[model samples]
Target: MRRAFPWLVLFLLCLGLTPVVFAQSQSELDELRREIAELDEKIDAAEAEKSAVAGDLAVAQEEFYEAAEAVDAAQVKVDAVQAEIDTEEVQLAEIELDLDTFKTALAATEKELTETETRVVDQTAELYMATATQAPLVFEFTDTEEIALSSAYVDDALGNSAELAASLEGLRDQADRERVSLAGAREEQQTLLAALDEKRGRLQTEVDALDEVKQVEAAEMGELQALVDGINANIAAAERHKDGLEADSARIEDELARRAARQREEEQQNDGGGGDGGGAPPPGANGWVRPVPGGVSSGFGYRTHPISGARKLHTGLDMSAGCGEPIYAANGGTVVTASWYGGYGNAIIIDHGGGVATLYAHQTSFAVGSGTSVSAGQVVGYVGTTGYSTGCHLHFEVRLSGTPVDPSPYIP
Candidate 1:
């Protein structure tokens, strides 16, 4: 066991300061407990906040993913619409090329038709003149065979003109039909192109909208994640602080435990060699024995003060003892005082029930408290040099009716 601080014990006994010291210690312990409780509350609050923030962060992340998926879906739709637009554009280009071909053919057919009509009109006029004047009748011919040949030639000429005119009309009709078909195809393609463009526009709009939503949700996720981090940080800090406080509390508790254990040990050691009527040493003439193993170094009478250099009544016998050596009770008695008294630092007084008391002073520490019964040879305290002392020893005294007397008559 560690030795007690004798000076501290002396100071405590001297000025009635033990209770104040203990009260301060108790107050400190209580403060530590209160701070620990408060820290626990803070930690709990921080954990709750962290949990809530984490939940929000999770929700935000889920929403972000959903928005990203929507964006992907919208992009796919836009791509599909663009593909349709490209196809429609190709078809429209082909229809335009067909329309141009049909237009050229129709124009050429109209020109041919016009030229054939003019030729037919001229032929009719020529034939009418011939009929009116009968210019084709054998007047232009030298013989009947020549006249027959001319009539055959005129008939072939009229037949060939009529056939050519009819062929030109049929070609015109065929070209007109092809031109109408090409125009219908071009119109349908243009209509489809316009519708595709409108659909692509709407799909692009949807894509842009979904993309915007995705951006917003992503940003929210970031903020919520940051919040979760901050909350976790707070919780971690609270836990660390709580741990520190708990460590301090544990230290204080350990100190208190040590003190209590020391106290119990001291009590057992002090009471070990004694009972009220048993284990006592054989008493001398007045039921007393030597209080310490160290015999008397100075007797109880005035010669000169060792510290003051003046003659005075020495109140006790200075018994030689090493520092921290136990001082025994001279007889079975009740302890009347176990504290400091003036120049007698860390002293004890025991009354033996007949206006007779024994004093043991300048002790390092007390083994028993006041009002305790002790037997002869039972340990009362350890020796020390305190007030008005030059070295470690016990100042032993015997008192009768509150007056100090020589202790030699009482102890052997």
Candidate 2:
């Protein structure tokens, strides 16, 4: 009964304080559950905010890259235009020199024409005086008395002296000999006048030919002058375009700097890692890449045209690669062109400096864009027909300066 009393007192003490502790524990558990739910909500909200910011950053980066590429293309276009201006300037200089030369020649020719006209007038006058109206007077002397003028003169005029005395014992034989000599002199003078006329006509013909040449030069000078004017106008236009590009480039630079600052701050917040790196390595040991891993269908040089069976200039090497095969760069270079080229379809051109360039044609799609620096053996595009091709093949070209060279010489 004494032990039972002690147990009862202990149970009462426990029962009296147990409910308060249990209630306090339940309140703490509920508060902890509510705190956990709030934390999860905050986490979802933070993740959404991060995703939106990242999207904005990605959009800005894309715009920056596009703007940069456009500016680069504009710069290249401006450079080409400037080069054209330089070429035109040189042409204009040569034209000016030619114009000066032609002008001088024209002046000399005009002087020659005037001299020829004067000579023709003078020669005509001289010929008229020498050939016309001067009919030689034939004097017929009729004498009634037949006197022996000279015995020796009469003998010379006759066939023989004895024959002459038998034939004519008068001075009639001497008069006939004198008449023959005068006729010979008149015939000789007329022959000389005729020869002079022929020479004058030939000279006038030469003069006329020269006059025609001068007229052609005068017409050519007019054309050259017009071309020079057009070239100068183009030069002025190019200068204006350059100025506008410069201003645009300055604005772009300012924007790029601001974007870069923002990117740096964002990077500090998120740490490293930005931009999806999408560039290509260049060609190296494999100087020549298989355009389509197929047989060489045609070589670069003169050959029979497949369509015409006639001799033609084969501008490039043709390979029988399958469609959609990766087209790699033959050497280390930058992609200078990636667009539809004449006869080349969807083509890609790489500039390997030192005035060397290579071309890949008949592409389905390009893996890289213009101005992208590439390494050897890097895939730049895929093979397909998009130009003047009859089949799925790659048209490859090796160029020195701007002239097509034998690709076989460089192929590995």
Candidate 3:
């Protein structure tokens, strides 16, 4: 009976240890499940954001094209107007040359008229002097033949002078009229040239204004394009992140499943051996709570990576919380991991029993240590912009059966 007592004590200890081992396995599975959920959420968010940005970028590019077209059209009009102005200027130059010719001709005509008048005046003056000096002698001594010849000479001279004066007066009048006509033509030509110049100026102004508008529109389009590019980058990053998370979650889930199966089989063996096998632990009484009391800044899903420009999955919910803000546990659980993790930065993972778990990432500091039990709404860490984070926030995740699932359903 004494030897049987020692064997009984050993059996009791084994029975007591069995539940603890099972619980630990379950916690690990739950944590993996939570991680998967968080990754899925991140991917969804990134995809949506990328889609919106792409649409905007398309519009911007369209607008930019339109602006370019406008600029081209305006340039064409400017060219056409310039051509017209050039033609008008050529006509104006021709008219100006014609005017100069007319003035020169008029001046020559006036000079010829003045010379004829001067010659007529000189002839008349000579005839008058000859008549005064020779009239008495000619009348007293001249025979009939001589008188007839002198009278013929005086008549011929006077008649020639009168004819020359009349011709000169007609030429002068004609030349004056021609000069007036040419002046009128020149004035008309000048007016036409001015009108053409004014038209050209207006056309040029219009072109300038259109060019300015085109420039402004082009700039706006460029800005829109840049925005679109940025969005595309974000989408790609999101997708890559999502893929990574999915792979990680799958691997972890498989490991947890294998561990769980082993735990179950061991329990079955223990039971068959007549060991006291405790029943499954009860379901958690505490419901899920938000890790941070803040709006979701980045949703879990595929998004463009900001730095790498790659499509990646984001595997967690980014809460818009200030740095150093307390992060609470989503449910009562034992801390599975509490340490600096690559990209997660000061992360803490909690394992609630029954294949449920939650993760808190990018924490400035941790309040709880690994293996420590935590209650729902217990402060587990503080928010931070650490390890791949753009700003201060809480990256929260939930898992079920070691597979990541959306935390929204579980978060309040």
lDDT string for model 2 (1-412, tens) is: 0011222233223223211111122223223222223333333433444444445445544544555555455555445555655565565556556556655655665565566555555555554444334532212223422222223223333423343333332334444454465455445545554555555455555545555544554454454444334434433443444344334433433343354456545854685643212222322254554444566789878998653355988988998877656677777789999876745756899999999899999775676789999876777776766545556678999899999998876656
The stretch of ten residues in a row with the least summed lDDT in candidate 3 is 14-23
- Over 4 Å off, model 2: 1-288, 307-310
Model 2 local distance difference test score: 0.55
Residue by residue across 238-271, what tens digits does model 3's lDDT show?
4454455445544543454465446545866877
Which tens-of-lDDT digit does each residue in 157-258 have in candidate 1? 577587876787798779878877888888888888889889889988988998898888887777767666655665565566656655665565456546
- Once fitted onto the true fold, the runs of candidate 3 whose alpha carbons sit more than 4 angstroms away are 1-87, 136-160, 273-412
The deviation in Å at residue 272 for candidate 3 is: 2.7
Ranking by lDDT: 1, 3, 2
lDDT of 3: 0.64
TM-score of each: 0.46, 0.31, 0.50
Misplaced by over 4 Å in model 1 are 1-33, 117-160, 243-412
Which wins on lDDT, candidate 1 or candidate 2?
Answer: 1
lDDT of 1 at 191: 87
Per-model CA lDDT versus the true structure: 0.71, 0.55, 0.64
